[model samples]
Target: MLRSLWEYRHFILASIRAELKGRFARSRLGGLWFLLNPLAQTLIFSIVLSQVLQARLPDTEVKAAYPIYLLSGLAAWTLFSEILNRSTTIFIEQASVIKKIAFPRLCLPVIVWGSALTGHVLLIAAILFVFLFFGHVPGWSVLALPLGITLISALAFGLGIILGVLNVFVRDIGQIVAIVLQLWFWLTPIVYPASIVPERFRWAVDLNPMAPLVRIYQDALLFGHWPQPLTLAVPALVAAGAVTFAFVLFRRASPELVDAL
Candidate 1:
């Protein structure tokens, strides 16, 4: 599958470019809208939650700390949810291509991930700019962001392909996914700090796979702290194992999935 994707690299790049153009084609501002949406969301959330949840966040010298904290977590969460959500129906979205195209079937999800990553890059730039306004520089720990993104991307992609394959057979899985993501978003500490959760119920936060990933982002961007090597090493191992399993599963089921479509 990796070799197949590499061989069709041009096709993948073309598809990603077309996907971006198509998404912004109708918007007056074009691709700027991608940056705008997240900026607007950060503003609105900062406005509402900043005051209400201000007490929960740690005492810090960083100006506009809440917004920085919120946006950092949001960055990781956005990439995650976008990939998982898109992956769930990517095959269905490309049903015609899957049925008629002779190229590798794996490219479909790669397209989804690439398209989403394009938007995410824009958002990350926007987030870093916002940090500047708050008198925060990109700390040395910011260097760790790529590794954090890699871990979560692998996790999301691994889970997404699994659900995507299952949803190809059971349509109801998509419906359940919507609800699950909604609840999952709240369960993770995107808008609020994990510190606010009662200690007794903190296990919910601890068990969530995305929690550590979000913390990695927040720790790097907001607190200027790099996690211990062991902290990231564990998830790195898990993500690698999970992604390999997902790709194997996806490859094995490709023929049947194409027929189902």
Candidate 2:
């Protein structure tokens, strides 16, 4: 699959471009929607939760600390959830093309990842500009964003492809994943800081794979600090394992995927 994807790399790139163009083809805002949606979500969350969570934030000179933290975390979460959500239905949505074309099947998830990462970059730039206005721009640690993004995208795509394959047969799998992602969002602490979690329930936070990944973004963008290397151990290992499993499952199920569609 890797070689096949590389061999058809141009197609993957073109498909990503086509997907991006098609998405905003008729919309007036076009690419601005990428920045607006996340910005709007960050604003809504900040207004509703900032008052309640303000006291919990670290003592910072920056007045917009909470909003910065929320935006950084949301940027990471949006990239992750976007890929996961779309991957679930990608095959089903493209059933017509799948039946008609003979391109690399792996291209679907790669295309989703590329398109999502493009939007994520825009959101990150907007978040950084907002941070700049508040005198809280991230330091050199901002360079580590690609590493964080790679892990998050890998994990999301891995899990997404597995669920997407199952979704073709079960149908309920898609709905279940939708509900699970909602629960997963709250569980990962995008709005609230992990410090606010009660001592007894801290174990649940620690158990979440995304907790560490999201923390990397928050630390770098909000606090302008390099992530503790040890913090990435779990999610990195899990992402590797998940990728291995996803490909194995996808490769084995390749033939059946079309028939199921």
Candidate 3:
């Protein structure tokens, strides 16, 4: 797998650049929209939850600047959700190229994941600015940010590859993916903190691949603490399993993928 990814390294890089350019090619705001999208969502969520939902999770140590807490979790979730959502149709959207080109089809999902990860970093930077303004300077635990993000991206990529291949044959898979992601977003503790969950339910939340990731983000960025060992272990193992499963499925479906296209 390392060899394959290394061999296609240039293709992956070029695809990343191409995806970024195509997204902002003619837009007035261009890359700015990346920061704006997450910021807008954070603002709307924070207001609505505080006002209407009266939502507040107990035992989560968010400072007086509550948006920082929400934004921290929101950034991680947005990146994971966006990559999974977009990757479902990545190959189909580029069907013309896939039909004509004989390059490694795996690169398509990787590129989409990379582009989404890039946008995620930009959003994280914006969130960091918000934290700084609130006098919450990031501590050394911030170093874990990249690892957390990478794990989330790997999880998203694994699922994306499987979905992208499946969508090629089963058109309905894309619609199902949309609905599943919507449900998955709520299941993740992005809008609310995991600490509030009862002891019994806490295990289930932790079992979610994304649950540990969001906790890591909040731990490092919002709470100035290192991620617990179990927090990292479960999600990393899940991501590895997901990637393995996706690669096998993609390999098995490669021949038919061409036919389906």
Best by lDDT: 2
TM-score of 3: 0.91
lDDT tens digits, residue span 1-261, model 1: 899999999999999999999997878888777667767877888877776555446757776788888789888999999999999998888889788879988887888888988888887887798678788886799998888888888888888888899889898888999999999989998888888889997988877878888889999998899877765665677778878888988988988997787
Clashes of each: 0, 0, 0
The Cα RMSD in angstroms, rounded to one decimal, for candidate 1 relative to the true structure is 1.7
* Candidate ordering by TM-score (highest first): 2, 1, 3
lDDT of 3 at 209: 83
Backbone-clash count (model 1): 0
Minimum summed lDDT over a 10-residue window in model 3 is located at 57-66
Judge candidate 3 at residue 84 and give its lDDT.
85
lDDT (C-alpha) at residue 258 in model 2? 85
Candidate 1 segments whose C-alpha is farther than 4 A from its true place: 52-56
Name the runs in model 3 displaced over 4 angstroms: 1-5, 52-54, 57-64, 198-203
Model 2 bad stretches (over 4 Å): 52-56
Identify the candidate with maximal TM-score.
2
lDDT computed for candidate 3 = 0.82
Model 1: ten consecutive residues of lowest lDDT: 50-59
Q: What's the residue-level lDDT of 133 in candidate 3?
A: 66
Clashing pairs in 2: none
Structural similarity to truth (TM-score) of each candidate: 0.93, 0.96, 0.91
